[model samples]
Target: MCVPTNAQEADTPTDTPTEAATPTTGYFDDAGNWVPPARDAAPDTDNCPQATWPPEPVSTSERAASTPDALPVTYDGPCGVSAAEGYEVPDDVLASAWLVADLDSGDVVAMKDPHGRYRPASIIKVLLALTVIDELPLDQKVAVSAESAGQEGSAAGIGEGGDYTVEDLLYGLLLSSGNDCAHALAQALGGDEMTLLKINEMAKTLGMTDTRATSYSGLDSAGMSTSAWDMGLAYRAAFDNPTFADMVDTESYEFPGFGDLPSFELWNDNKLYLNDPDGIGGKTGYTDDANHTFVGAVNHEGRRLVAVVLDTTINNDHRAWEQAQMLLHEAYGVSGSVAKLAPANTDEPETTTAAPSPAAGDDAGQEAGTAWNRWWSYAIVAGVLALAVLVTVLSLASTKKRRQRR
Candidate 1:
């Protein structure tokens, strides 16, 4: 015999609602809003007056599973979404940018428009420094040329016609990002032409296929462009040099004066050195064309991340840093690692092993060596000079055409 289970009788209602209904429990809509039944209300039944209270709202968990932040996600290892929250980078912040490889392992991490051409700004000095150090002995004295001393922006307070050791100028160049230092170093190495040649040669050697340099100082010169990836490549190449790395990392320096000049103090322009304890080093740049630009590296935990931001709007340094930190956190999450330098591509003939450190020796031999090295460094300089000329001619031609149209 079949016996009726409680489920069969559960549909029976205990109470019914009157015309002037007092609210009892069950499903009911309160003016379009779902109102859950009070604890004391009776359950809905098949036969009875309609209840006043609405049914319970659906929980997010009961809704679509594809929605983000429905629940805390977990992964077995470090390879997962970034744990650091509250960093939402805007998509349109920088027109062009790129990031790559940990400082240690040389593995490329992430790239945003990596190959896009943009102004290198002061970052160009990384290559210039490499060329200068390779060609000039650190202890050798270089007389400041009129061209170098006359450099317009961010001077190291170096006087024209006075002599400074290669070491002091290198420090001035990296720490202060001085245009004067760059020109002095260029003149000391290969004059203008050879200095630029060495920079271009180094670019070629490093596989910077899209990079072009028009000046050693990275002053606003026409057609002075390089891709973010190319800058990263240049950084990787320069990082191996202990002196170069040390120079960039320095917080402050005191330059000994010459003749009647007083000693001068210089501080690093990179804000990261002061703000971030893990900041290894960085460079900052700004021009009407380049806008606010920065290339910085941070060491988090055991990993190192390098970030390059270009063409950002003015007064957005904080935003730039935020974006960089977010990208680094994401890269760290994805790879469970940070940036590393790429291995030297032996297949490329232009790529040479890092220049050997100069040995302290005879002053004449060193000067001769420096001069000879400069002579060989003219190719990049010529390339940059040509670019400058091209830019000037184009500007003039455009002006003339506009006048004719008017």
Candidate 2:
């Protein structure tokens, strides 16, 4: 999670209690001010004109198991089943929306308000980075446009006409959480409107059902939103790229000055990398509307886990990270016996129950209702080999003791 360094920290956002439309008139200027196109200027492509901000909540079914849209159709677990079964839950988990998922199994191990759509803040930058990394060449130098130089919030400090490589901009976007870096990349990828469209398109393709990208930078005003589950899915997709993995995992980067922009060092905003041995690195996000949001991955005891925490407390010892750490620690050792809750509907926060966690003899428990199959063959093989090795070691040690006794 982020230190007090990130600005835009405030209580949960109250704006757009109803659906807020994506602004077609203009985008944010250098000062992070909204700039409209000229009176006769052609309207920017309104890719998501029908979509509105803080998407209007829809009605859902009363049953948890059959709860419609409880999770994105692409998620592996049962549509309406509680994902938290078979795991020990963390205490005082301050996040209003969070998820802990098994990437290898594609199983959402645990969640709370997983489908609640909330402002994403800088977390939006990750999608922007992925989009750019795919479309633009990292070695290509992009000239900082007026809009980019004028961008506000945490910035890469790109001055007007400062030309930087796509590589540096990505580093700035992910590590520094640079709003200006987001703008530069978005512009490079064909302006903010098109980039937002690309973001949503990728979200659709990746099966990230609740994410809507209206802003390149995650300004609360830009109306970017996603659920905790959506973020975990998005991050999982991003990590597939070697470039993204390299950049996000980097602790710090040294940017070479170009043109009017002087060289500067950028450090990752997330402390999870520095503090947690298992942390695989991810991004941090914050805004008045989003509060403290984070999406990260970790390798715990050889198991890959991705976690998302949204709307966590602002000043409580990085509650999001702490909660994630505690949860990951438990997840590594959890038995497959805890009962699960039914999945809540997309539009509601209600809960339902699932059958108790499977017993040793239970061959057909939680895997019955989902679209995905468990991919535990590799794990089983590895486990067996490890056990065999442990037995051999003990046998050898016992023989040594026996010899000494003789």
Candidate 3:
């Protein structure tokens, strides 16, 4: 899951709570500080004008519905529901936009401003991981460059000039929200520009119409955008990839060391993974501009469900995970489809491919690890077979080995 390195899951309960309790309702002041309403007073839902297509910042406005004609009629309002009459969503939900959907059926159970545009923060790493798993071989080693080693935000501690397996880098990307690991993977995929090109291509393939990635690390960037609906699509697509599924589901791993770096343990920081037995996996993210964003899945009563929360805040009483749990709980027995996730468009031409790793005879000979050299040569020898088939075969075998080991 993606998060700033210094943040802690202090609000996450060691055990899942049996009841969903609403937290205190508050408003942000002129200085962007939270101000609770008067005691026993009605929530000031009318503090500002109604919500519109391009929602106004929550710090300055009330969130009532003004766009009732929006797509997916059931979810066209500020607070949406697909349940029976009198069904009230948890009053404490604080996200500017959120969604809960059935993974298997692609049925959207409930939502609030489902299509509101927002910054994705680090949760966009989900797209990056999916791209890496598809294009690069897991066992292939990448030599970390200084650019990747000194990435700006959270890090997985990969050292410059160190050799790391693609699989391990992926672990760092998801488990630790490592911007450094993300950059290294982006370079291996052909550098920042090409990687963004491929990731946006993948987003289109998966029918994530509202997403446009600007950086592989999911840090705030110009034009980086995603919606709650799009994040739901991302997590749903992720369930089909065994490697992606396995990595997110893993709670802890012994991340390897290289060069002067020492080995350190990495733990899955997705609050759902840590606190709920039913939570399968998820991604987390945060940025000053994006606030806190989360995408998570759960297995409940034989049904698989995914939830997304965007542009939320962390008060003393609740975190993003807690809001997700409340939404998922409200969603379990509900049985109506306000909307459906679009299936991938197969006719879209597949354009994202792994960049050819340089061979030993090339400039890469000095820095390429022995394993990387071997893999590169083997890839050349197996060029007769389609790239898709080779990656599928290797991924299946690797997943089998991982499962068997457990």
Strongest candidate by lDDT = 3
Number of clashes recorded per candidate: 18, 8, 0
Candidate 3 has its poorest 10 consecutive residues by lDDT at 8-17
Model 3, position 225, has a per-residue lDDT of 72
Q: What is the overall TM-score of model 1 with all chains considered together? A: 0.59
List model 1 lDDT by residue over 94-211, tens digit each.
Answer: 4345564566656656554444556665777888889887888999998887777777656677887676899999888877777888888888776889888888898888867656
Order of models, best lDDT first: 3, 2, 1
Q: Which stretches of candidate 1 lie over 4 Å from their true place?
A: 1-95, 315-326, 329-333, 336-406
- Compared with the true structure, all predictions reach lDDT values of 0.59, 0.63, 0.70
Q: Order candidates by TM-score, high to low.
A: 3, 2, 1
Clashes of 2: 8
The TM-score measured for candidate 3 stands at 0.67
Q: After superposition, how far is residue 235 of candidate 2 from its true place, in Å?
A: 0.8
**What's model 2's TM-score?**
0.65
TM-score of each: 0.59, 0.65, 0.67
Each prediction's Cα RMSD? 29.0, 18.4, 22.2
lDDT of 2: 0.63
